[model samples]
Target: MELYKAAMVLGGVGDALGYRNSRWERCPSGVAILSELKALGGLEGITVSADEWPVSDNTVMHIVTAETLVSDIWSLTDLYREMVKAYVEIVEQIHKRQPDPATIEGCSQLKPDNYLLGWHTPFNKKGSGFGAATKAMCVGMRYWQPEKLDNLVEVSIECGRMTHNHPTGFLGSLCTALFASYAVQRKPVVEWGREMLKVLNAAETYCRKTIRHMAEYQESWFYFETKWQSYLEERGIAQEGQNTPKFPKIYNAEERDQVYREWSSEGVGGRRGHDAPMIAYDALLSVDNNWTELCNHAMFHGGLGGATGSIAGCLYGLLFGMVDVPKGLYLNLEFREKLEELAAKLHKAANEGEAV
Candidate 1:
């Protein structure tokens, strides 16, 4: 119960804060659609007024994923169909409104007109955006058991493909989900970090082996492998045949600040799928269970603040549960009650070993 509540609430808080920070010039399509959905009571009676801190597509999709799992709609195909239905409804609402150019551009990629044809028919976006990782908390929370980790990874990939079909996008989503699942299961931070590297290596190896037979995934596979290798090199962990290098545990304030400085300059807060998870992982390692500090450091990264913050928040919330999350963080969250309600439903589902 505590795990479910903490993941939902903390992740939402992070999303709200991140959305608030990023809504300066342009609003994301998910945010715009979710806003309209809220106004029309399409979001389970949850509404965010104009004055409230608006959530991004991250929270919107996170809620959808959570609701789907808690409802026991376990089949991947069925889950994808239901998610597409929800996404199409939001896209329709988005079209009704006078959204900004960025929102329109994002909506164009969703291919709402072709949605009814089949789940695989939509035009897949090639960009490795952070959308997949942002909504992966639910997968981790729902399948936190060690024995369930394989299923968790498979489901995470399926959910990622629903919007972000590329390997880079889905792999980032897998890492985030696996991180959250590991954290929820009380795995040590260092162990999880090493495990994440292994997962990435395995993914890269699989992609390499299958690239000849499956040419479609080549571009994304190459992109992820190259970028991830560069990232590992920058962090001084790249070595010949070193699949799982030991990630340094940032224990001091000075070390944490140095990492933040380095990543901030490297565009850690941008829209890339790879940067946010690494930033989140760094924040988690640096802060040592201080959720507030972790979020603050994550938010300091500007553009990707909310996502980085949300990832860190989800992990921290999972590690410590709700009892330890500072109450002050909850005071001004606009959709706290709605998130709490959803979390309760998820908790009930988990407790009963089936969705009610």
Candidate 2:
């Protein structure tokens, strides 16, 4: 299978698996409503049940991103506008279903406070939510110009700002995109981390320069930089005096559970923008290109396991292609065919330099 198809299908599969396993506990109403949509044949023939899993907002946004890119909107500004339009359409469709309040609350945070009446708007707050980051893989993989890494970072940030407008959110999106770009090139996983740090350092400079002109974002940018630095330090990706830690070794189920507990101990597990990618990164590093183990580790994180799993799955799909992903995961996944078709469209667009 093509890299794009592998990434999209595996990512959605991971999202569905994680959503089915983790989200119901805290958002029972949301889960039930989504399940109902599946049963009613309202979600594109996607179904959710005790034996089947359906995709969530993560996959929804991801598909939107892919769709926008393939829509032939080449310029950054046009691309951004198209993405916003696509996102609103998806959100409105869900809203028509009258999702539970808690679910609406989750969706509402994606829109700006001054959102137009009857229209779901992008969040204006400097949120560090993982939603944007989880859906960014396709954007990264869609455009591959090493010389335009800076541009890629900027575009990725813009895609993220459609919902999550915080620097941490942007960073998470940036990291995922950069990793995907590198993965498609068949770079070593360590190279992915090293390239990430290089791009991140440059991105910080870009943020510092850009934020100066956009004073309103200064505070959030400052917070993001400080927190991101500390996050890197904690992961041993950055240190005052020592070599960066090597990619983590693969963990057994017990070890994976322990890592989850440790992360939760800090009151920062599952859903935080930084935490999800961080967990995914750790899982990626721990494995020796073992897609199953990476997904297992990510899924074990609880609550937002789907987001983490999607991130890990994207990287795995990019690196190893679709064959490596477990066949069982696709058995009852929602929109499997659509996801594959969209992925093929994206890959073709990128290769042909034409609108999808």
Candidate 3:
């Protein structure tokens, strides 16, 4: 398995398993979820069939972004138009998949004429959900070059703000994309959070100078930075093996939820934009190259399982490729072929430069 293909495929796999027809995602207890997985034969015994373990809107919207990026839209204006059109089209499938409310609201307000007029969706203060982050992987894949850091930051903000106009909302998109780029570069997992903070400074510069109504969200713009800093601080404490607590081995439903919420700066685990990416980052850092532990840390945490799982799975897959992954995870995954195809195209685009 190629690196890019593994990344995208595992992303879908994570979304599927974490979702499990919304059974595991909605289940508040990690212990209970693990028990259920045991009954169903665990990761090796379970197949990621669409009928049983179908992916939610997390993977669906991700593919939408990947498809639009690969299309023959070279310029930013044209790219935004194509992306908006593709996002609008996904509304047809929203009923089948449980979508984020921010996604639905933002996509509903998009119009073809708006993109043509050099405008995106209106400012959405309440749009600080993880929906935009879910589809940001390909943006990183497309511009995953050191020289293209400016392009990556700019384009990520544009795509993120297309729907989530608030800084907190769109910055989650930026973090997801930026981390994917870092993964492709094979940067150390421990360095990712710190590196992301440095990149956040760059992102803040861009937002302050470029966004038309930056002042509206300026107050909350640092929300993301604060959250990342907190995560890094906690990580540092854990690395030192100090009195800082480690992730608990067992918990009831409410206890599990409370622990994760406490882990989140946003007080909601992976439910919001700030916490989802952070949770995924934490998952990537916690696992010592163990795929199943990766699954446990990323998904079964009584949060937005699909979103965090996809983000973490994609990063882990990109970093390690498919050598260590269980075969059953991808053997029956939905749209496996299509994911590989897109991965190849995205890899080519990232390496050889985007199509002109």
Task: Please tell me which predicted candidate would have the highest lDDT against the true structure.
Answer: 3
What's the lDDT for residue 141 in model 2?
76
Q: Taking the tens digit of each residue's C-alpha lDDT, what string does model 2 give over 41-66?
A: 53334444325565666777787788
* lDDT of candidate 1 over 59-83, digit per residue (tens): 6667777777766475655666676
Error of 3 at 331 (Å): 2.0
Candidate 1 lDDT for residue 113: 47
In model 1, pairs of residues that clash are 18-306, 269-304
Candidate with the larger TM-score of 1 and 3: 3
Candidate 1, which segments miss by more than 4 Å at Cα? 21-52, 92-117, 121-125, 200-213, 225-268, 322-328, 348-356
Estimate the TM-score for candidate 3: 0.92
What local lDDT score does residue 181 receive in model 1, on the 0 to 100 scale? 79
Q: TM-score per candidate, in order?
A: 0.73, 0.76, 0.92
What is the descending lDDT order?
3, 2, 1
Against the true structure, candidate 1 reaches a TM-score of 0.73
As a whole number from 0 to 100, the lDDT of residue 314 in candidate 3 is 88
Q: Cα lDDT for residue 76, model 3? A: 74
Q: Where is model 2 more than 4 Å wrong at Cα?
A: 21-51, 94-126, 204-216, 220-268, 354-356
Better of 2 and 3 by lDDT: 3
In angstroms, how far off is 284's CA in candidate 3? 1.3
